[model samples]
Target: MGKDFRAIFWKDIRMLVSGKFFLLAMGALALYTLYVNFGYVRLVELSMYKVCLWDPQGICVDGSLLLQRASSREELDRMLLEDPDGVGIDLSRGKAEFLLYRSTPQVERYLEDYARSLLRPQEDFKAEVLGAFTTEEKQRREITCELLFFELSAVGFLGIAAVLFREKGMGVLRVHACLPVRGRLFLLSKLAVFLLSDLCFAILLTLLNVGVGPGLAILPDVLVETVILSLFMALIGLCCALFLQDFRQFTMIYLVIAVFVATPVFLSANTSVKAGWILFHPFYHLYMGMKNAFFGTPGESFFYYAGAAVGIGLLYMLTAAAFSREMRDAPGGLRYAGKDVEKREEG
Candidate 1:
C-alpha cells in the first residue's frame, strides 16, 4: 500500500513539474514577497490623503504642511474633479466646508476627521493600540495570510485540477480503475502531493515575507491551518474537474468561484464592509483561521474545524462517486475523456 501510494505520489510530482507547478509557486512567492515588503507597506505608510484647500478669505488660519494650497475656487473644483479621492476644503462662506467623493461610512468619517484635524492641528486625538504587532509585523502577517488564502483557493486548486485533467486527457485515470490500489488512494495521492506543495509554499512565503523569527514562531499552527485549507480546496478542485465537462466549463466555473465567492470573503474579512451572512461563509472562516495562525492567535471557533471536516468529507465522497461514474461511462473503444477532442477541435 505504501509503495503504491509512493508511486502515485512520484507520478503526480512529475506531472506537476512538467506542468511547471513548482516554478509557478516560486514565482508567486517571490512576487508576493517583493510586493509586501517593498510595495504594499510603503503604500500604506504614504496613505495620508492629499488635502486640497481653496480659502480665499483665509477663514482657516492653521494650514497643514501636508495640505496643497489652491489659488481659486475653480482650482479646488479641478483638484476634486481630477482626484475625487483627495479631500477638498471650501472656505468661501467663511467656514471650512469639506467636499469629497462619497465613500463608505467608515472611510467618510475618517476623511472628515482627518480634514478637521488638519485645519486644527492643536486638537490632538489619541488612540490606544488593541493589538501588539508593530506596523511591519502587522502588514507582513496580513499580506502573508491573504497570499496563502489565494494560493490555496486559486493557484493550488488550479494546479491539482490541471494535473488531474492531464491524467483524464491521457486516460491514465481510467487505467487506475483496473489497478490494485484503492480508488480513494489515487485521489488521496494527488491531494497529498498538492498539500505538501502548498505547505512548502506557506512556510517559505511566511519566512520570506514575515521575517524568520516571527514566521517560525507561528509555523506549526500555520501548517495546521494550511493542511485544512489545502485539503478543502484540493477536494473541491477534484470534484469540479471530475464533474465538469471540459477545461472551458471549468474555466467558467472557476471564474464564478474566484470572482464572486472569493471576492466577498476578502471584502468582508479585510475591509469594514459588514455582511450578516459572512459568518456562514466557509471560506471566510478558513481565511481567518490562516490569518490567526500567522499572528499566533488561532481564533478558530468550534464550528470552523467541524464545518471544515464535514465539507472536506462531502467533497471527497462526491469526487469519488464522480470518478467512478466517469470510468464506468468512458466513451466506447476510447480510453480517455479527451481521446476524441482533437477530432472535435478540428471540426
Candidate 2:
C-alpha cells in the first residue's frame, strides 16, 4: 500500500509538473504578493471616507485630514451630487449638520456614525483591542485570506478537475482500474498532490503578504485550515470530473462555483452587504478561519472542526463510490467493434 501510494503520488506530481500547475502557482504567488504590497494594502490604507465640508462659520474644527473645505453650500451640493459616496457636511449653521444623499435607513445611520467619528478626532475614545495585530497587519491578513479562499475554491478546485478530465480524455482511468492499487488510493494520490500544492501556496502566501514574523506565528493554524479546505475542494473536483461528461460541461459548473457560490461568500464576509444566511455558508467559515489565523486568532471552535471533519468524510465517501463505479464500468481501454471506443484500429 505504501509503495503504491508513493508511486501514485510521484506520478501525480509529474503530471502536475507536466501541466505547469507549479508555474501557475508561482505566478499567482508573485501576483498576489505584488498586489498586497503595492496595490491592495496601499488602497486599503488610504482614507476611509472623503469628507466635504462647507462650514463657513468655523463651527466645526478641521479634525480629520480627509476633510476638504467646500467654497459654499452650492459647492458642497455639487460635490455630493458628483460623488454620492462622499459624505458631505453642511455646517453653515452653528451646529454641525451632516448631509447625505438618501439611502437605506441602516446605511444612513452608519454614515452618520462615521461622519460624527471623523468630526471628533481629538476625543479620548479607547478602542477595544481585538488582537495584537496592527492596522496594517489586519489589512494584510484580510486581503491574504480573501485571495487564499479564492485560490482554493476556484483555482485549485478547477485544477484537479482539469487534470482528471485530461486523464479521462486520454483514457488513463481505464488502465488504473486493473492496477493493484485500490481505486480510493488512486483518488487519494491525486488529492494528496493537490493538498500539498495548496499547503505550500498557503505558507508562501502568508509569509509574503502577512510578513514572516506574523505569518510564522499563525502557520500551524493556517495549515490546518488549508488542509481542511484543500481536501474538500479536491474531492469535489474529482467528483465533478468523474461524473460530468466533458470539460464543456465542467466549465459551466465552474462558472456557477466561481461566480455565484464564491461571490456571496466574499461580499458577505468583507462588506456590509448583509446576508443573514451566510452564517450557514461553509466557505464563509473556512474563509473566516483563514483570516483569523493570519491575525493570530483562534477560529477553530468545536463546531468548526466538527463541520469540517464531517464534510471531508462525506466528500471522500462520495468520491470513492463514484470512482469505484467509474472503474467497474470500464476496466480497460479495450472495446470490441463500434460498441466501445478502445479497440478501433486502422484509423
Candidate 3:
C-alpha cells in the first residue's frame, strides 16, 4: 500500500512538474514579492490624504501636517473644485464649516478627527501604535498575509483543479481505477502535492515580504493555518474537477468564489468595514488568523483549530465520494466504453 501510494504520489508530482507547475509557482512568488515591496508598500506609505483649507479669518488652529494651506478662500474653492476627492474646509463665517463633494459617516469622522489633531491642545489627542510592528513592518505583514491567502485559496486551488481535469479529460483517472492501488490514494496524492506546494509558497511569500527574522518567528502558526486552508482548498478543487464537466463551468464558479465570497471577507477583516454576520463566514476568521500570525499575534482559540479540522474532514469526504463516483460511472458509460475495452479484456 505504501509503495503504491508513493508511486502514485511521485507520478502526480512528475506530471505537475512536466506541466510547468513549479515554474508558475516560482513566477508567482517573484511577482508577488515585487508587488509587495515595490507597489503595495509604497502606496500604503503615501496614503496621506490631501486636504485643502479656506480659513481666510484664521479661525482654524489645527497643526496637522496633512492640511494644505490656501492663500485665499478663492484659491481653496478653486482647488476643491479641481480635486473632488480632496477634503476641503471653509471658514468664511465665524464658525468653521466643512466642505467636500461627498461625505460618508466614516469619512466625516476621519475629517473631523484630522481637523481636531491640528488644534493647539495636541496633548489631548494621542496616536496609539496598534502593534509592535513599525509602519513598514505593518505594511509587509498585511500584504503578505493577503497575498498568501489569495495564492492558497484561489490560485493554488485552481492549479490543482486544472491538472486533475487534464487527467480526467484524457481518461487517465479511469485507468487508475483498475490498478491495484487503493482508490483513495489518487485523492490523497493530489492533496499531498498541493499541500506541499502551498506551504512552500507561504514560506517564500512571508520571508520575501515580511523579512526572514519576523517571518521565521511566526512561521509555525502561519504554516499550521496554511496547511488547513490548503488541504481544504485542494479537496474542493478535486471535488470540482470530478463533478464539473468542463473548465469553462469551473472558471465561472471560481470567479464567483474569488470575487463575491473572498472580497467581503477581506473588507471586513482588513479594513474598518464591519459586518455583523461576518463572524459566520469561515474564511473571515481564517483570514484574521493569518493576519494575526503574520504580525506575531496568533489566535489561541481552540475553536479555530477544531473548526479547521472539521472543515477539512468534511471536504475530504465529499471529494472522496465524488472521486469514487467518477471511477464507478466512468466504466459503465458509453463515453468510457472504448477505454474499458482493456478492462474487460483483462477480466
lDDT of 2 by residue, 1-347 (tens): 99999998998898899999999999999999999999987776544556788888876664676677899999999988987877888888777788887565557876776676667666742223466767787788888988888898889998999888777766678788887778878898998899989999999999999899878988998899899999989999999988887789999999998888788888877776868898888988888887777667875799899999999999999988888777776432232223344345534
Point out where model 1 deviates above 4 Å: 43-102, 106-126, 332-347
Candidate 3 lDDT over 42-138, as tens digits, reads: 8766355567777777876755666788898878878877776567777678665667765666667776556555543366644443667777888
Candidate 1 displacement at residue 102 in angstroms: 4.1
TM-score of 2: 0.84
Candidate rank order under lDDT: 1, 2, 3
Show where candidate 3 strays beyond 4 Å: 42-45, 51-66, 79-97, 100-103, 267-277, 331-347
What TM-score would you give candidate 3 relative to the actual structure? Answer: 0.83
Q: Per TM-score, what order, best first?
A: 2, 3, 1
Query: lDDT score of model 2?
Result: 0.83
Cα displacement (Å) at residue 55, model 1: 15
Query: How well does each candidate superpose onto the true structure, as a TM-score?
Result: 0.78, 0.84, 0.83
Report the C-alpha displacement of residue 160, candidate 1, in angstroms. Answer: 0.7
Which candidate comes out best when scored by TM-score? 2
Q: What's the CA error at residue 115 for candidate 3, in Å? A: 2.6
